[model samples]
Target: MGNSSSLHLQQEDVQAIQDETGFTPQQIERLYSRFSSLDKAGKSHLTREDFLRIPELAINPLGDRIVHAFFYESKNGEEDKVDFKDFVRVLAHFRPIKKNQEKNKLNTRMEKLHFAFRMYDIDGDDKISKEELLAVLTMMVGQNICPEQLLSIAERTIIEADTDRDNLISFEEFAKVLERTDVEQKMSIRFLS
Candidate 1:
C-alpha cells in the first residue's frame, strides 16, 4: 500500500527523546558508541562504518532517496547502486534546517520553564517553599480536607514536583512534570487560581 514504511516514536520514546534533548543525554548516549535507531537500537549512528556500509551510495538527500528507491527495487528482486556523493548532498541540505528547528524547540522549552517559575513566585521570592507548595496543592485538592491528608499531600506535591536540586520547585520543572501527566487548556487559571 505504501512505497516505504515510516518509523514513529512511541509516547514513552518521544518523552525520552525530548528529555534527552533537553539535558545531556543525546551527546552522552553517542559516546557509548550505541546507536539511536528508529525502531530501537538496531540501526547504528553515522560513522565511518555506516558511511562506507552503502557501497555505491552517497550520504546526501538524493542518495537517501535513491537508497529508498533501491530498497523498494531490492524488495521486489531488483538492485541498483546509489551514488554516495549525491546522498551526502541531500543530508547537507537537511542539516541546517534540522539544527535551526532543534534550536527553536530548545528555546521554546526554556521559555515555558521560565514562565512557570514566574507564575509560582506569587510573593516574588524567586524560590518556591513548602508554604507555596502547600497553598497550591490545597487548591488543587479542594477547600474541604483533613489536616493529615493536607500534610501528606503537601509533602508529596513538593517532593514529586520539584525537579531541580535547589530544594525549591521552579515553575519550569513543575510544568514539565505536569505536562507528562496532564494537559489543561488554561494552565494559567489553574495555577493562578
Candidate 2:
C-alpha cells in the first residue's frame, strides 16, 4: 500500500511539472533520469561543478554564464545548487514555443530574449553596460580577436543597440535591436517527444 501511494505521488509530481513546463510526461521522465545521473553525490541538487562536468557545456563559449543562469535567483548567501524543479524550469525556457502558445507563456519570444539578456547582464543591473558587453564579447571571441578589435566591435554594437543614447542597453533597447531576429528559432531546443 505504501508503495502504491508513493507511485501515485510521483505521478502527481510529473503531472504538475508537465503543466508548469509544457513538457510531456516522457520528456520529464527522461530529463529526470538524466538529472539523476548528473547528481553524482546523490544530493538531489546539482552544484556548479556537477554541471561543468558535462563536456559539451564545458566547451561552449558561454558555458559559465549559462550555468550561472541556473543559480541567478539564489539569495542570502545560499549555496548555488539546482534541484529537479529548477532544472526543469530553466530547460523549459529553451523549449520551442508552440504556435498555439499564448504570448504570456514562458517559452515566448520575450522570455527567451530575457534569458539571453540575463546572460550578458552579469551584474543584474537591468542594463547591459559597455563593460558588460565587452566582457561577454571577450569571452566569445577573445581567442580570435585582438583586445582592441574586440573593444571596437563591442562599442559599435552598443552604439547601434542603444536607442535611448543612455550609454547602456536596457531590455527595451535590447528587444528593439533584436526585433527582426528569429529568436524563437535561435533559442529553441528540440526535446524528445
Candidate 3:
C-alpha cells in the first residue's frame, strides 16, 4: 500500500538519523526543529554569527568558547558554516535526554563532561593546562580580571579538579567535577534551561 510505503520511508529516515547521530527519532525531531530555527533564513545551515544568536548560547557563560569550538575547532571543512549534521553531532552531547540517560548512564555523564572538557581544552591536547583554564576564565570574566587574579583562579580550579596533581585536568578529573552533586545540578539547570 502507498501508506505503508510512506511509513516505511519515515522509519528509514529515523533510522538514518539514529545511525548518524546516535539519537532516537524523538530527540532527532525535537533537536532538528530547534537547529532549523537557528538558520533564520531557512537556509538549512548556520553561519558562525547565526549560531551565536541562539538565545541560550548568547547568555551562556561559555558562549564564546562554545561558538569557537563548534565553528572552528570541529574542523568539518564547512568553513564558517554549520550544517544540520554538524549541529546535531555537537548538540547530541550537550542536550540531555532522559531516554538516553536510562540507556547509558556512564555515556551520558561522560558526554556532558567531555563537552565541558573540550570547551576548556582549547588546544586539543586532551588536557586542560593552566593556560587553557586561564584563557577560559578570563573570557568568562572579560579582560577586567588582572593577571595575578586570573592565575590564582586558574590554579585553584586546577587544584580542585586535578586529583593526581599532574598540573593538568584529565578527563577523569573532569568527570569527577561533573559528578559532584552541586556541579551536576548546576550543569543540568544551565543547559536544560
Candidate 4:
C-alpha cells in the first residue's frame, strides 16, 4: 500500500509465478527488482522505459508483453487489486512450455541420435549417403520401434536432426529427437485425455 521497497514479496508469489511462467528464480528476481523500483505512488507503476529496458524479455514464446502489462496495470491501480494470485495469472500468460529451448539445443540421447544417423548407412558405406537407402530402411520402417526414415521421413528427419552439415547422423545429432521429454510428456497427456 505504501510506496516502499519495504514491500518484501514473499516466496509464494514467486513460486506461483515461476510455476506459471517456467522462469528461473534469477529471472523472477530481476523482474521483481525492476518493478519494485517503480514505486511511483507508494503504489506502483511500470513505464514504457521499463519495457524498453528489460532487453532479455521476449514476446515471442512467453508473451512477455502481457505479463508486463498486467504488472503495470495492477501497480498503477488502473485495474483491480494487485494480489499474488494476479501475479500468477500474469505469469501464466508468459509461461514457456517445456522443451522449447531444448528443441534447439544439443541432443539428449547422444548415442541414440548417432545410431539413428548411421542406421541408414547402407552399402556399408559407413555413413548415410544422399542416394537414399530405399530397400534397407524401407524394410525396417514399420518393424523397428522408431523405424528408419524410408527416404522421405529420412530426408527431413535427418536434415532436421543434423546440427552440422557433415551429411551423417552421429549419435550426438540423433539424440536430439529422443531427448524431447517435454514433447513426450505432452503426447502422454493427449493420450490419456
Candidate 5:
C-alpha cells in the first residue's frame, strides 16, 4: 500500500456492500482483490492510467468512454482517480447475475449511458456537440486519422445518434444510441469466478 490512508475499506464496509449489493462474501473478496491489484500502492484511489492499463479495458470498444465516465461520475472530484466506494457504484452496473433483474439492469444501463454522455460532453453542457464528439474520437484514434476523415466520422455518428436531428445528442438521444440489445450484450461485464 502506497499510503495506509488510501486503503479505507473495513470489514464493515465489506459487509455493507454485501448487504446493499447482495454480493456473496466470495464475490466481495473478488472485487476487493481486483481493487487491490489496480491499487498497486494499495492506495484506495485508482487512477486513469491504472484503469487504462487493464488489458481487458484496453481492448474494450467503449474503454475510453468508460474510463472517462469513471472519473466524471465520481461524487467527489476524484479528479483522475476513483475511490473504492465510487468503484463499487460503477461496478454495480455490471454485476454477473443469472437471475434477471430487468428493472435494475435497465436503470444501471441508463446510468452508465448518462455517464458516457457526460464524458463526451466536454464543456459540461449536458449535451454532446459534433466538435466534442469529434474531439473524443480524435483522442481515441490519435494521429492515425486525418482531420477530414475524423470530421466525416463525427458527422455520421452525430446523425446516427441525434434522433430528433437537433444536431446535438441529448440524454434521450444518447440512450437511443446505446440502448440496443446488442450493445448492452457487448457492454455487459462478467464478474470473476
Candidate 6:
C-alpha cells in the first residue's frame, strides 16, 4: 500500500496530475505532502473521518458539502474514500482562471458553477428544489436566522432564480442568475507555487 502512494508521487505521475489539475509541480508536491500527513494510515487515500478531523473544516459552515464534493467522483464502490488524484482534481475547480491560462477545461467558469450547484443539488439530481436550497441555506445561516426566516429566504431565492417557473432551479437558471457575477474571481483560490 505504501508503495502505491509513492508510485503516485513519482515524476511521471506528478506530471500527469499537473496536466489534469492545472497545479504547478511544486503545488502538487505540497498538496501531496499534506495528503500524506492527513492519511494517517498511509493508504494513499483519505477517509471522511480524516477530512472531518481538520479543525478548520470542523467549524466551517460548508465543510460537509466541501468534503462531499471531494468524494463525489469516487467510483467502483469506493465512495467513502478519495485517492490523491481525485483529491487534486476536485481542488482544481478552484484554480483561478488566469487571463493567459492554458485551456484547462476543469478550471472554466462553467465547471466552477457546477461545483457550487452540486452543493445545493444534494440528491445528485440535475435541479435544485426548494427543499434542497433550504437545506443548504440552513447549513450556511441557520445559526443566525430562525427557521421561518430561513425558509422564506430559500423560497425567495428559488423564485427569483427559477426562470422557467418550474419551481426548481436548473443549471441554466442557476447560471443565468449568476451571469452578472464574476464567478471566475469568486470561485478561485490562490494556490501557492
Per lDDT, the best of the predicted structures is 6
lDDT of 6 by residue, 57-131 (tens): 899998999999989965425898899888888888988877877947788889999999999999998999999
User: How do all models score by TM-score?
Assistant: 0.33, 0.89, 0.69, 0.29, 0.71, 0.92
| Model 1 CA deviation exceeding 4 Å by range | 1-119, 139-143, 181-193
1-193 in candidate 1: lDDT tens per residue? 1111112334454345435333222322332222232213253223333444554545342334333432322222323322222222222221222233443332343443443454445455666777766665554455578767887876777788777766677666667676763222222121101
> What value does the lDDT take at residue 114 in candidate 2?
93
Off by over 4 Å in 6: 1-8, 75-77
Cα lDDT tens digits, model 2, 81-184, are: 88887888888888877777644356778889999999999999999999999999998886899999988988999999998899999999999999999999
For candidate 2, give the lDDT of residue 10: 80
Say which prediction, candidate 1 or candidate 3, comes out ahead on lDDT. Answer: 3
Summarize candidate 3's per-residue lDDT along 1-193 as a digit string, tens digits: 3231332236676676567556766666666667766778977678878977878779877887888767653436876788766766665554444443442332256666776788888988899999999888887887787889999999999989899989999988888776755433343432323
Which residue pairs overlap in candidate 2's backbone? Answer: none
Q: Judge candidate 4 at residue 51 and give its lDDT.
A: 40
- Model 2 residue runs over 4 Å out of place are 1-9, 73-79, 101-104
For model 3, how big is the CA root-mean-square deviation? 4.9
Tell me each candidate's RMSD, in Å, in order.
Answer: 20.9, 3.2, 4.9, 17.6, 4.8, 2.9
Best by TM-score: 6
Please give the lDDT score for candidate 6: 0.86
